[model samples]
Target: MKLLSVNVSKPKTIAYDGKSVTSGIFKESVAGRVMVRKLNLEGDGQADLTVHGGVDKAVYVYDLASYHYWERELGRADLAYGQFGENLTVEGLPDDQVHIGDVFRIGEALLEVSQPRVPCFKLEIKMEMPGFSRQFLASGRLGFYFRVLEEGMVGAGDTIERVKPGPEQMSVRETAHLLYFDYDNLDRLHRALRIPALSQGWRDAFAELIGTSEGAPKKPRAAARAWQGFRTFVVDKKVPESRDITSFYIIPEDRVPLPVYLPGQYLTFKLAIPGWPRPVIRTYSLSDGPCHEGYYRVTIKREPPPVDPSIASGSHYFHDQVEPGARLSVAAPRGDFYLDPAEETPVVLLSGGVGLTPMISMLNAIVHVGKTRPVWFVHGTRNGLHHAMCKHMRQLAAENDNVRVHICYSRPRPDDIKGLDYDSSGHVSVKLLKRLLPNREMDFFLCGPPPFMKSLFQDLRAWGVPEGRIRYELFGPASLLTEGTRIPLRKPKPASGAADFEVVFLKSGVTARWDPDYDNLLDFAEDQGIFPEFDCRSGICQTCMHELLEGEVDYVVEPLDPPYPGRVLLCCARPRTDLVIDV
Candidate 1:
């Protein structure tokens, strides 16, 4: 192994997207010997210390082979040794071959591989290619970052020798691929987590992957459902909770004792309207506690007119068409966001507008346990008129000394008295939370509109709340979130214990087994090396929709907004039979 060039550069400001941007991704080859410091190379500095220039990422190393490949791939002859902003450009260390935690001796400096280099927008600017960062990461040519073990000075043409290899069986590309692409490999995640030299950020990311499994004991799979695929639910009563929100009490026709579900879980309903050819499915949060008084309750707000009026709103169908004693096919309660009623820690149920549905359930369940775990039920709406179940929430707080409810009205009505109707006249924010709550020891559970969810999430993070303590149920993709970035989750495995199936990707020409371990076709397809574009894997988005050429499939998650005609939302679908799909 040999060093072709040692590059160094300081942070520089540049204009991008009509704003000033600063980055240190522009390095120039240094002529002579350079000092390798604990945090960075001499004369090299990063603009951001939060994500860059840490002791673990002191040096960035890129292989010459990747540069050569990119030169041919981009049809550009202007590629340079330090084009990737690497402090070390070497010939022998391939991204796929170098294992994270591997120690190497280069000249007088000793270093160990910490983690794979994730390309930021700065890389796209450096390459003068838009969307190149995604392409670079997906290509698995992302070079690795290094932790300087011993700082020393050496220059170009220095021989590199391996001191020790990473004990884990994952390369730089493998670790990145495990995180970004092949994320479902729990075995690999655990393996990567075992490496002590792995960066703390990567370690935390891996820990979050298994967070749910490591938390409170979950109900067994067999005990979770009271009935199979879809059960007949008869609406015993439908009452308006507020001017805009209504609650429906549903019970099985046979009057079976419904299984007690975790609080904050949602119920999926399949509506077979007279005019519709197929069942229209929608998911709504359970508003009542998990005591299951022979019935399950769902609170819903009537949806306003959608941009496309051709498609009827599911909530509208529930409010206008569905009546008392109406029969509906409802799936059993499910969702990872649900909270076990037995938790002893301080819990915060935060919500905005109609988002209070799940919070109501959570609050009711905690009160049912009568545990003095310090519960805070905080909610916000436009006014008392817009707030649903205000009396019910207040009653719960009044009844339980451990529970405290704080109401916020962004724009309160004239009749809305501060003491009676609301406690605050502003939005529910971290500022209000800090004043209302005792401390940061509480675990926050938030469900709200995008803006409300995003702001509060970012605020809590900025206030030093741990990521695991701030839980949320987002209607859209978490990727669109600016701060407190969270990874979207899917069922770890297919809920069905049915036999394995086959799925064919027509465009990719790959016919592969639909492993029983895969929750949906998207993960199965990805395992087969057919990665289709996707967002909001919960089926809210149609990004993963594709044409189903042949065979039938069942939706593991029914998209409230259905995909166009024959196209299937691969993220939430599982093949019922041998299937062929146009990628």
Candidate 2:
């Protein structure tokens, strides 16, 4: 289906003169006709079938291109009007056509149509234009939630393409109504539940609806016999230089066997703090290699200004408030950044301040495994006093002739030299890097603050390091790093001669014919208004995880997780054969 129109509008609250519009005015404002692609509706009440708080009060809607065509031709803006909380407004296409598991690629970014929009009371106020909410209920043209699938720059006029389509018989709108009005509708709910396209929040809610009264079925008692309890042990070590950062040695209570992990992988720990709304899960990189017995080390740096002020002091809360005896819920180690032991080329490990954690792990792995590859470790810190793991790093270097460590200090105190060796009195610069190596064949592993990372990357490029050899880690929100630099958009290549393929949506029992050159299963789904939940279209985030019920596919890039035995990341995965997908 070709796009007919794209519209966007920013939501604005209007207060009437002495009328004091409460819910009604908000509803009336929601009904206004605006030609905008994104519309943010505002109100303050519970909307039916909303995931986040205030979502019910502030509804956003988008009209599809097909709907937009009708709206434009008939000059019927109300058909696209609704009190549903919508941050985006679109015209054209049947609302039911968008499915929960589908992803819409707009510009360089992607958005998954997570769930259907739920109308709020504010519509009654905005509906002042006419019978807006009633018309919306009658027309069944509600908008849906778009979980950002891929993050990048976005604006109006950008084309939208579906990367994955939901099963045909079950529509997102149908699922929304089923969830909103009749959550107990077992038959429809069962069908929606089987689609796998549903969001995790909706899935939990559905599970609660169906199985809440009775606790989740218990595992066989025999299964419990296999459970090994965890063992706990603690070893405290000082950083020598940085007192604010400490490394803790961990010993599990059950003494259960822990799996070996890649050097740069992180472990997620779920902590329950008193007075907190829910258990908080945080991930920290393993600061050392898997060693003899069951011990792993993690370094904690005091956060200067904790993002959540409720915690009083950021790092202090994690350090002083948290106790060693507290049980921590843990996730298995996961990461894609690892040193390739087989590459005989010289390797360079770069880090700044607390970014040294993963680099230390890599260095430890290299030393422990007795790899003979030449390694150059370059570390940058605010000053020698702020440098962490100084003693341990120096000891490792002293023991290994193949390893060399260079420390750069931005600001140095005369007495700070007591605990540091191989120290440089200035910031790391391309000139210094050139002076140190003079050669450019090393595989660079760099991680640090955004600015340091950016400057280092630029210098690496100028030094002619191949794109494939340079790998880095993003410690925070992927959005924090400027876009268009890390991963450049691939220019759409001219279609190779078309090849016929079939995509079987297993749940729907429908097979769609596709041309390899013209159809990307994901994009085609969005064009037909199907949206799948996804993030990091580059296959970094495991958001768009899906199983391959049948057939083969080739991934455009390496995925974060080893492709689940039978699954592929739909965002970057392409069919290598006639395919059957579970979603």
Candidate 3:
């Protein structure tokens, strides 16, 4: 087999992992000979050395024959060489025929086959396809990695000749298949363990799997996993639910089944915009039921920019710029706020404005599951003009005998009729809630803007609702929760001697006293004009992760995903003691 193309690329900065990342996936075929080195091609670079770029995975090669299959599968004839982020596009040497430790000579370079490529999100970013990683693994056409045995110049049309086959009987295809699908086949796994050419990462994985296996690999604990980064999704359709709200129907471009998600969970999107230095990350609630097939829907409101310009705004982009056929980078559905299907207690879904998104998900899930428990979907908005999904909500309520729908419009338009358009004409308060439902024993799930959430949360407490039964989700900046719940509306007189901790920003040469009203270190730092990079102040994004040089911090709430060992997410952590941090 001959090399069809020699590709190389320098790390190119792109928006990834909720921050700006330099990736080497945008490789281009070099016209002439390129120097092949022990670690990587002369011009090539890997952004994260921990995952890519090592002697064991110095070069990535794909068989040119697979391009034909992909061209047909993707229905595009314009697929080019180096499109799969391959360093060497060869005419032959598919995974099934390439065994671990097999040595080959191409041009003047001697290289050894190391392992099959374990696909990552970079593949998704390179191909602009969501679910590509899973699909690639399932296809069994995985390419093999090569470690240069002799550094030499190689170029297109170099003939690849097998010099010597190693003693290992395990082929690249066999190893990957065993690792991915036939994981439970301990006999084959044990055989693979003997292969000397297996990559260290895969070897460690296999070792761990074997250690954890009692005839079968144990299920991975959820807490131990990190976000798999963004996957590409296509907007199949956009349905206008109301004047201000529209629902985007997204489905995997690879046609894979949607990941299992509970009702009320949200899908976080990493939106790439040309002018923005970093991709804007935003979370939108899944508006459809989990039982819905072929697609997942997220309802979004077109939020107008606030009078203050500093606040981030992506609603305008979603409503105006994004359209059908737009490719979107979407994370898996995730959120702590969700309805428990196992619960038998009555459910009360309360919302104001677009907070109804999650409520709709919970309601649809209950209806789809044919749950017989009582459900109340109560919402308040400006009027009929601003109300969204009313028809669908009414239909579900009508179909389900145990479900009730209540719409309270604070202001009615001139043409709006009382009974037909709205059930009430005032803001939904404790008195109004009592009058409508009269039962305080139901599980209350609240979501809305700060004012709505704060008022309802306090009113619920005052009306004797159990704290455990009352759940709420604020739209943004979770620090609002601390402000709404902990800090009193009126300023309190200073205590005789309240202990204050010192927070020293070593880089900026600034220090600030930790005040009780400060929600977190990030907040306090921002106030002191030392704004560290931050996104998703709720602690989902690790953009604000800084090294804790000489300090201790306590989290206001445990983060969804923990930071790296020596780093702390300032967004959620408060200075527990006088500390120094490397921002």
Candidate 4:
């Protein structure tokens, strides 16, 4: 595959315009190509380009990683720095021809097509050249997202080489089309759904669409009953350390079929705190590998004062108020943070304080899967007393000869120095990390508080760890990561005067006026005494879902479960037009 036109536009807003090419580096991956041409807008008075070719290509429009190609091509060294709608603007390839696990070499870098992108309203704004959005939607050439297998420099004029063809017989395009456009085509969708390459997001999307279709196979009413209300569970477990952090073994009381989750996933618990009018929800990552029937484990750290009041209160409530016998309402597991067992490279798991939960899950999974790769586990904590699951980790290390554990204490107490099996007494500095894991080729997974995670990320980059191999998880909301990061977080400014928007809940028949400051659609509805079912309230849960009968909305965080066409998570979603929602 040959590179065609390398176009870029730096709009006042990160939103794209067909005019001047943006001044930034652009990175492109080899995938199915789509036809590109310029179009004229009636009132915007600007020429916008439209990408065509490929049926059911809705995937490409909303994918952030795929959009990196366009950003890199614009001369932006930081591919994740800029905001472009989609990445590569191509000409020949289509979705039906490409398959998952397919490896392609673009310039010197290697990428594997992991999954199809899911479209969103951001594309409509990016392609505001009259009917550009509509035409692209009709054409259905949504591009795909790729996982970087090998990292190297890429540029325009480089040929894309197909290194490995995917094993699946069906292309992502055929699956997307059958699921989205032709709901009546159940046979094809079900058949494609059986493919392991199909993502859980796509599967959930298809399930929603097909389940709502006319004359679709009706699942037993009992199956739907399982998900109707929140399930409560009471869990009690022991923590190895004497610190405030504790581990709990949780199992659903209703015996409901639990959704299988990945190692680095988290579950949001909704607690009914006394004196609080509404339920309080917080997210905590699972601390164990996947099990068939055993209880899932979670480790929680009690936060002391002087920190943010909200977090401190929440942490205190979980530790002090919530008891071992008390039942807690929980949402299904959700998150994109996961380790790929297919990755055979050396692994480095980094954690600080309570952030060790997910890393424990990953290490346990690696060991469970019997992966023989060299494993380096580095943990940082205030002291041995505060170290959250030190005993469990020590036991695993003792059992597995391939695993190596390194502990760094920021503040070592008199007892900590005598009792702990720590390798170092200082904080996790670059000097210690380099000495422990001399090779920089390992995949690095870091999880911690914002400060700790950020510092480690900077240190790893300074140590020359490739960007592709360095993965991280935000402990709180996506906003936390957006703050002071390379990516710009431009909160939409309210209009000069209060711009009133009429939002009609089509299903509930509740009409409300939305204020610009109360931009969150879900929050606006809740304020109006119209409660939408929500769990995380952070956009991770797909519960506060509503179909968009009319108008537009912007999603602040990428949903773990792909939204059904014209549907959105009301929590972090903001309306862009006078709206109608099926609440």
Candidate 1 lDDT over 433-500, as tens digits, reads 88988798879999999899888887887788877798888755454445445433333555454656
Assess candidate 2 and give its lDDT: 0.58
lDDT of 4 by residue, 22-52 (tens): 2221223333332222121011111222221
Taken over the whole model, the C-alpha lDDT of each candidate is 0.80, 0.58, 0.78, 0.61
Rank order by TM-score, top first? 3, 1, 4, 2
* Comparing 3 and 4 on lDDT, the stronger one: 3
TM-score of each: 0.52, 0.46, 0.55, 0.49
Which candidate should be chosen as best, given TM-score against the real structure? 3
RMSD of each: 26.2, 26.2, 11.0, 23.1
> Compared to the true structure, candidate 1 yields what TM-score?
0.52
Considering TM-score, which of the candidate structures 3 and 4 is the better prediction for this target?
3
Ranking by lDDT: 1, 3, 4, 2
**In model 2, how many backbone clashes occur?**
59
Q: Provide the lDDT at 309 for model 2.
A: 55
**Which scores higher on TM-score, 1 or 4?**
1
**Cα lDDT tens digits for candidate 3, 1-583:** 8999999999899886457757898999998998899999989999888778899999999997788878877887877898888899999788888888899999889999888886766788888876676677678777989989999999999999999886666788998777654544567777777878777777766765555343221122121222366678889799998889999998766443344466787887888865778877777888876632547899999997868665457788889888999989887776667885535799899999999998998888777656798998899999988999988888887788989888889988987777777788888788888987858999999988888887888888778887778888764554454454653332444522343777788899997777767777887787688878876676776788999988777887566567888788988898766788886
Q: Backbone collision count in every prediction?
A: 0, 59, 0, 23
